[model samples]
Target: MKAISYARYGGPEVLALGEVRDPKVGPDSVLVKVRAAAVNPVDWKAREGHLDGLFESAFPVVPGWDVSGVVVQPGVAVSEFDVGDEVIGYVREDFLSRGTFAEYVAAPLRTLARKPGNLSYEEAAGLPLVGLTAYQVLSKVLQVKRGETVLVHAAAGGVGSMAVQLAAHLGARVIGTASEHNHDFVRGLGGEPVTYGEGLGERVRGLAPEGVDAVFDTVGGDTLRVSANLVAPEGRLVSIADVDVVTYGGRYYFVRPDPEDLRRLSELAEAGVLRVHVSETFPLHRAADAHRLSQEGRTRGKIVVVVDWDAGAEGGSQGV
Candidate 1:
């Protein structure tokens, strides 16, 4: 299959577009014909070897985790989906190879969920990782409740935007931090947008004088450190951005594949309560450009890589 891969960890220049062998489908996995794939910061992070000690890495790695497409063939033990069923998956496995950047991914069932009826392939592709991150952090880690106020750092980001919507859908008042340009965008997603940088807590307090019930940090560094002071003593704090969160009595989170969690996001999308914004789309061969854009750390929504819009069952063959 045609795919983007790197022989060694380095810069975007190291990525090469070429044909690669198909991924092996385990008994519980399915081979998917990828219509689109979404780029996340982790893609570039892994490409630069930033996650070397974390994910088991190998050379000639394909770098992507979010895929939206159709199931072409299901493994022997798989019954949740069949041929031609539309699906979205956060296809992160135990290691770093056979990613969603390719034309096909042998995705395990746990990572695959039925695509939301209201979302396109690109939109669905954008949801799995970021959407699941916010869902898991709020629903599982923080346990946000109705009428509570939740603060989301970097609210305009891929994950932060979804976090804002998810928190609001849960009936919590959302306060999101973004640049002035994104204030309306954040508000459109049901968050009260606050400007970032110094005095962030003071600005947030100007809206919620009682202090927020929970803090969700999507941007690390000072934003996270400063937001810590704004959370009430009994409030929960969760972060996917910083390991230092643990030092401040917060839970450091990593998103895991959960069909149930993803299903909830799908339901929310279908119900018009959750939406994914795609900032840009690149052809599969231009994956490096997508990585570069994500590396800039300025994107308001998601960046997607389009494989074959009209992909077919025969095209699903990946040398398996």
Candidate 2:
């Protein structure tokens, strides 16, 4: 199978498209023919060895987790899906390797969900990781209530964009932090935009003089520290970016692969409660270029790498 992989930890330059052995399916896993894969910051961070302490690595690692695809074969123990069922997944394992940036992936049943009928493969691919993160944090962790004022950092970015919409859907008044250029985009997502930087605290305070009821921190470090001072006395704070959030009475969260959660997100998309904006897409062979774009950290939404199965067929072969 053709896929993007890296033998050693490094930059985007380390990623290369090449033919590798096909993934093996397990008893509780299904082999999915990948149509699209979404790039998240963690993909590049893992390539740079930044997550070394958290996950065990197997070299020549395929670096992607979010996928929208079709089930090609189901494992012996799996009955939830069969050949040709369209699906989306955050196909993460306990360690690196066997990822979604490939022609196919062996996704565990726990990570798989039906693709939303209203979304394209590219848009569906972009939803799993970011959507799951936002859903878990807002619905379970933060428990944002209606009429509350919620602050979301980086509202134009993937996770932040999803968070902004979900918080608003929960009936919270959302205040999102972004650059001046993205204020309109943030507002489109049902958030009141506030430009981040030196005057961030004051700007948020301007919207809710009593301080916000919850703060969703996607930008850590100084931003996280600043967010602490902007939350109301009984409010909650959660960070997906930095563990240091705990120092300020906040919870640091990590998104997990939950089929139920992914399914709910899909339902929301179908019902028009959530929408995923795909800012750009690259073919599978140009995944490195996609990585470079994501590394810039200024994308308005998600970046995706698509498998050109039609192009492959035109070249006289369909299977990679």
Q: Which candidate gets the maximum TM-score versus the true structure?
A: 2
Assess each prediction's global lDDT (C-alpha) against the native: 0.90, 0.93
Taking all chains together, each candidate's TM-score versus the true structure is 0.95, 0.97
Clashing pairs in 1: none
The candidate scoring highest on lDDT is 2
Q: Write the per-residue lDDT of candidate 1 for residues 132-210, one digit (tens) a residue.
A: 9999999989999999999998899999999999999899999999999999999999999999988887898899887
- Candidate 2, 1-320: lDDT as tens digits: 98888999988888878877899999999999999999999999999999999999998899999999999999999999989999999999999988888999999999999999999999999999999999999999999999999999999999999999999999999999999999999999999999999988888888899999999999899999999999999999999999999999999999999999999999999999999999999888788889999999999999999999988811122212
